[model samples]
Target: MSRIQQRVAEAKAAGKKLLVAYIVNGDPQPEVTLPTMHEMVAKGVDVIELGVPFSDPMAEGPVIQKGHERALVHHTSLKGTLELVKQFRQTNDKTPIVLMGYANPVERFGYQAFATAAADVGVDGLLTVDLPPEEVVILKDALDAVGLDNIFLLAPTTTVARAQKIAEHASGFLYYVSLKGVTGAGHLDVEDVKSKLAAFGQLTDLPVCVGFGIKDPTTAKAVAQLADGVVVGSVLVEKMGSLEGQPAAAIATAVGEIIGGMRAAIDSL
Candidate 1:
């Protein structure tokens, strides 16, 4: 089984839900990336979605967009993101790392070469934001060849037919965008999310992870009750951004404490 599937299965077996955390790599600064990563995992993050900084991140909100801008200022390329994963692996190997970004960098890096290098650097999955299901066969084949899962997003407006197509193509876990708008936007109705998750349960056995507007422990707990996993991106990134220019230990404490509360809430479910 893929590492993602294994981790989800382990969470299921333990009667606990998975807590997936998202962070823009090289955000705030390049040197802060690895420390934040290790700290998130140490606190409660089961899966790490390390976002590759991109110029045109359509799906991202203002917080992540600013983060991307900061990362780009450091010239954080796709290759540099892979190297960060390699450096992260030097100390930690159990936590699954998923490169989350747009397709331009991966395309520039070449499908086959990106797959091989990602696998070599201990990356467990890829979540290309703008890549559609119909266009993922080549990338999927490349990823499958190297044992990396290709994760996909399903929005609130996705039709049943499209959802099925996504379920068919997606591995790791399917990310369900809870709100219709972009990331970090407010207004996440838990009842609507619950209904959508119920509908998705009928279509695929793959674990469903809900993201977008999941900004706090209460919201995380509510989402966890309905889905197999909860993903909090914008808020955490915002917190990290707030802690910029501080000591690494301070950032770790602030971020860890915030996510630790989230972990506790999810576990409380």
Candidate 2:
């Protein structure tokens, strides 16, 4: 199995849903990002979805938009993000890292070159938010050649035909947008999300992870019962933004508390 599949499967075997944490690379400051990542791993984050800061992150709301702005001030490029992953892998190699961003950067970075750099830096997956599966053939082939998983997102508005198409293209896991709006825009209705996941489950065996509105321990635990993974984004980014000038340990502590609480809640389920 791939590193992502192994880690996610291990969570399943343990009777607990995986906790996937998202952080914008170089947010607040570049130096603190890696330490904060390690802290999340220590506090029970099963997988890391590192956001590659982009100029136009249409899928993000205010909280994540602010994060991208902060990271971009330091000029965090696609190559720089890959360098951060390489630094991260020097000590820790087990936790999977998924690069979540837009397609413009990858296109500029050259598809083949980006895939090779990503694999060399220990990146396990890619989720280009704006890339539809119909246009994903070349990029998907490049990623497949390098043994990296290409993740796709499905939304509540997606029709059955579209869902099947996405499922066919998705590799690591299928990220199901639990709401109709952008990330951090709506209140997550657990029942509605459950029904959507149930329908997708019948279409493919790919792990369907719910995201976009999961903000707290209560919601995380509730969603954990229905999906293979739970992804928390804006809330954590907000916390990182709040700790801008503070020490690295402070950022770690603040983020760790939120993830640790959700971890406890999911395990108890």
Candidate 3:
């Protein structure tokens, strides 16, 4: 099993839900990224979805869009993100690191080369936001060869047939976009999410992780009760942005507290 699968399996065996945290690499500043990542894991993040800065992050909301812009100012390329992962691996070898970004950078990096380098740097998965299941074969083949999970997104409007098709290509876990819009867009309707997850349960046994519209411990707990995991991004990124110009330790502490609160809330279940 890949690190992601193993981590999820471990959480399942222990009767715990996964808490996947997302943050842009080189955001605010490149130096702060590494410390924040370590603090996040220490505070109870099960998997880390590190965002690679892209010029046009279509799926991200204003907060994360600003985060990408901030990272871009520091010239955080795909290779730079990989180097951060390599640095992260030195101290932490267990937590799964999944690179979340667009397809253009990956295409420019070459599928085989990117997959090889990612695996070498301890990356566990890839979530290309705009890459659909139909166009993911070549990339999936490369990732599969190196034992990296190719994660996909399933939206609330996805048809049953389309969802089944996505499940066929997804591994490690399925990221269920809780909101119909971009990341951090709408209010989460718990009942709506519950019903949708129930529909997904019939199609695949892979872990379904709910993201978007989950901004606090309350929402995380609500989603945790319904799905295998909860992915939190915008709120964290917003928090990081608010703490910009502060010391790295301050940023890490403030962000870690948010993760800690969610962890406590989820464990309370």
> Which residues of candidate 1, in runs, are more than 4 Å off?
none
lDDT of 2 by residue, 1-269 (tens): 88899997898788889899999999988987899899999999988999999999998999999999999999998999999999999999999999999999999999999999999999999999988998888899999999999999999999888899899988989899999888888798999998888888899988888899989999998998999989999999999999998998889889999999989988889
The alpha-carbon deviation from the true structure for residue 65 of candidate 1, after best TM-score superposition, in angstroms, is 0.5
Q: Report the Cα lDDT for residue 253, model 2.
A: 85
lDDT by candidate, in order shown: 0.91, 0.92, 0.94
The true-structure Cα RMSD of candidate 1 reads 0.9
lDDT of 3 by residue, 1-269 (tens): 77887898899999999999999998888889999999999999999999999999998999999999999999999999999999999999999999999999999999999999999999999999989998888899999999999899999999888999999999989999997899989789999899999998799989999999998899999999999999999999999998878888899888899999999999889
Query: On residues 61-152, what C-alpha lDDT tens digit does candidate 1 reach at each position?
Result: 89999889988999999999999999999998788999999998999999999999999999999999888987888899999899899899
Which residue pairs clash within candidate 1? none
Ten-residue region with minimum lDDT total, candidate 1: 244-253
lDDT of 1: 0.91
How high is each candidate's TM-score?
0.98, 0.98, 0.99
**Model 3 TM-score?**
0.99
Worst 10 residues of 3 by lDDT: 1-10
